[model samples]
Target: MPLAGLFAGALGAAIAPFALRLRGPYLAIVSLGLVYIGIYAARNLPALTGGLNGTVVTAPVAIGPVDFAALQVGPFLLTREQGMFILCWGILALVLC
Candidate 1:
């Protein structure tokens, strides 16, 4: 996930200059074109995206000793959704800082 974020960041940085230069309708057109291209690629790439069927991406929801999937804090046990909420907010706070 971190690597994917990094790759997306890099791709965004690479495109920013050209994207930033456009204004109004031209920017909207370009953005729409890129979105279509992305959708088409995802639909066609079977090995990478599972084509039209799509793919499931699963990763261990643990950070060292803390397992977000089944988080236990003191006497309180959190449900998966609650644990994920906390984990996501924590990450967002860290990134914002």
Candidate 2:
């Protein structure tokens, strides 16, 4: 997923030089269409995205010596959230780097 985002960003960067050639409504329409298509693709790929029902992601790390599934944190205790946060931040850092 992180790699895919990186590729997309690279593609966008490559296209940026040409984007300036487009003007006004033409540029807006093209950009909006791309956004719509990306959203549509994500929604349709059930195995990849799990659609509106959402998807299950396992823990990125165990909570100390305990099993991550058995661990609790505050009221909304879940390993998935921690995993996602780590995943997102890791990707963000990769992008920044």
Candidate 3:
């Protein structure tokens, strides 16, 4: 899905050469209109995006062979907080990569 968005953005950039012939204010208006449309779509499509309240996300389970449920570090046992920490760091690593 991210790759598809990247491709779509590239296609938009490729088409910008034609749009560049337009006046600066016209281009800005078009861009702002598109942004408004995107925001409207996101708000109206509740079934797809969960509306303004947002959506619930399940935490991931384990890190490689080490089961998160079984992990115990010092006095702290692995629970929801640790699981969330692992999940967040994993996502961060993926984004950085």
Candidate 4:
């Protein structure tokens, strides 16, 4: 659920004070170690993460009237890849602006 993301965000905020203490290569090493730990957890925790094979994430594809699962612009209907491309770039452009 989206609440999980909020929890993660709160966890990160709480951990920032400790994580920000490290500098230079220490920070890099810690970040890399966290990545490895996540990978290891995902691989070992099959029930939670679906293991190394990964799992399908079927989240909602619509926001209001815009349905990304079947995105249409004018007369053209976009494929999933095309929709994703547009969505990603749109986000990027919005951030940049």
> Which candidate tops TM-score?
4
Name model 2 segments beyond 4 Å from true: 55-97
Q: What is the Å distance of residue 25 in model 3 from its true position? A: 0.5
Rank by lDDT (best first): 1, 4, 3, 2
Model 4 TM-score (2 dp): 0.55
For residues 1-97, could you state the per-residue lDDT of candidate 1 as single tens digits? 8987997799789888999999999999989988898799788887876688745546778899899989988999997778889999999999999
Query: How do the residues 1-97 of candidate 2 rate in per-residue lDDT, one tens digit apiece?
Result: 9998997999799878878799999899879987987789788986876676865655345545744444465675666556556556766999999
Q: Residue 97 deviation, candidate 4, in Å?
A: 2.0
Q: What's the lDDT for residue 23 in model 3?
A: 88
- The TM-scores of all predictions, comma-separated, are 0.53, 0.44, 0.41, 0.55
- TM-score for model 3? 0.41
Model 3 Cα lDDT, one tens digit per residue, 1-97: 9986996699689858977888889988877876787689779998965678865656556678866655677887887667667777878999999
Which is the winner by lDDT between candidate 2 and candidate 3?
3
Q: lDDT score, residue 66, model 4?
A: 82
- Best-to-worst order by TM-score is 4, 1, 2, 3
Model 1 TM-score is: 0.53
Model 1 alpha-carbon drift over 4 Å, by segment = 1-21, 47-49, 52-58, 72-82
lDDT of each: 0.86, 0.73, 0.76, 0.82
